[model samples]
Target: MAIKTWELDSNFKNEIAAMPGGEGIMKCFQCSTCTVGCPITELEPSYNPRKIIQMSLLGMKKEVLESEEIWLCAVCQTCSERCPQDVRISDLMGAIRRIAEKEAEEGKIELKGVRAIFEKAFMHQLEKFGRMYEIGLSMEYYKKAHGGFFAGMMAMQKDYQKLGMRFFKKGKMGPKSMFPDKIKRTGEVKKIFEKVGE
Candidate 1:
């Protein structure tokens, strides 16, 4: 985390401020309100919103963009509600994630965790079906996460078996859930995704 002069990009903060949802980046005044209010920070001290913002402002572009911490945000907006500066910290995190995603897409960096994988799976379901298909999403996520369907099932078997039984008993999951019908006019969903450059 050492601040090497050569590693800094002086315009990095401005770059973030110019992005949608990141317009308030310049408003953070090191108040630490976002960190204090972040529920994720409470359970995982390493996921520090304040530190990420500080790093972003300091022009630590590589560190911030490559961080696994940015993807950990739950997007609950507690920090935004509590910010004295109206920084919209939750949205700021989203902005950062967008940038990270762009970087990964362009091959500037490799994303390092299941969060991104899960998001892709979730979004694929929405784009393809115009709504969530829980069984399909789970299968896709597991397949991508573990490299294959059988491998993923084996990895999650014990815990998922118990959970699956509970869900079945409660009528939350069953064979009927496996064959979810796609929403009418699913093309609209793809159009929406395309509009957002997804």
Candidate 2:
């Protein structure tokens, strides 16, 4: 395969470098530790964490920024754990996600299906109960992603019962309520996000 070199704008490099975990791209040696440690790469070759860093270093911002593959990363932390250079692969991906999310906010990007559904469910939970109710959020997310009853029928047979039990259990609480003090702290965090227009 011929390696493609993108002609990226200098401002893009500066933009990415200013991100929290994006500053170490220039120091990478292509050791491939991040690649080898990423579990998702085993199933999806397009998600090479090391290659992501290389693309970032080369300032292929468009390709990197427009990717749904970055969203597929579940942040399992294996890549970060195995990185010999101590590069925070999860954090770098988070920085990239912020860039993509900013573009999404500007209407330049449109998230499809699961991503949009997930986002809506997440925000709904935050706005309604001040934290995520995992079971409730999951059901809402599934319904939104599947588009209605017919699409989720098969999945429901396998997982819905379990999730419903969790959701309706008398003693269950949302993630925030599980820790009394953390709820207050999370409210403070939400205030900070609101201040930043998040």
Candidate 3:
């Protein structure tokens, strides 16, 4: 990688520390323990937890905030568990993700489209039904993925039709399963979701 001078914001660390679970970044040393424990790094050699923290501490704001490395983390907490410094690596990653979201909204960085769309769609499913509705969730996901209801339905027809037939034959999952009886206290669940406010 070619070196570029960082337009470092000295306050960047403090800004991240202000977010939930980010304070642990300050406790991280360049020990590489986090990196060693990260399963993602084994597959994605570039997804190094130690490098991420070092870059963040150096205030490489644009690169760190915009990196796919942050999003690549599986949040399994192995890094945190293996850390000698008690740096909660997974939580720190979450903080970085939150910062990425805010930066995207403020137009400081480009957002990852599919990741954001599916996150919203999944959360919408949670808010809409008290429990997960797989078919509804899949439809919502496809809707967001394809950009509309009709288009999404048409797209699913090629494959979901086959899957639907299999589900029906097996009496496993299909239309009836998808549209199961909603919880009578769905209203209460809605209230809880509203209180959480996403």
Candidate with the greatest lDDT versus the true structure: 1
Give the C-alpha miss distance for residue 29 in model 2, angstroms.
2.0
Any idea what lDDT model 1 has? 0.86
Q: Write the per-residue lDDT of candidate 3 for residues 72-93, one digit (tens) a residue.
A: 8888999989999988989998
Candidate 1: which stretches are off by over 4 Å?
Answer: none
Q: What is the C-alpha lDDT of each candidate?
A: 0.86, 0.70, 0.81
Name the weakest run of 10 consecutive residues (lDDT summed) in model 1: 152-161
Q: Across residues 16-85, which tens digit of lDDT does each residue of candidate 2 receive?
A: 6688986755667889998886779999887788887777777776677777777877888888788777
Indicate whether candidate 1 or candidate 3 has the larger lDDT: 1
lDDT of model 2 at residue 99? 81
Residue-level lDDT tens digits of model 1 in 83-197? 9999998889888888888888899877767888888898888888888887778888888899998998786675477888899999988778878669889888789999986
* Candidates by TM-score, descending order: 1, 3, 2
Name the best candidate (by TM-score).
1
TM-score of candidate 1 relative to the true fold: 0.93
For residue 111, model 2's alpha carbon misses the true position, in angstroms, by 3.9
The RMSD of every model to the true structure, in order and in angstroms, is 1.5, 4.8, 2.8
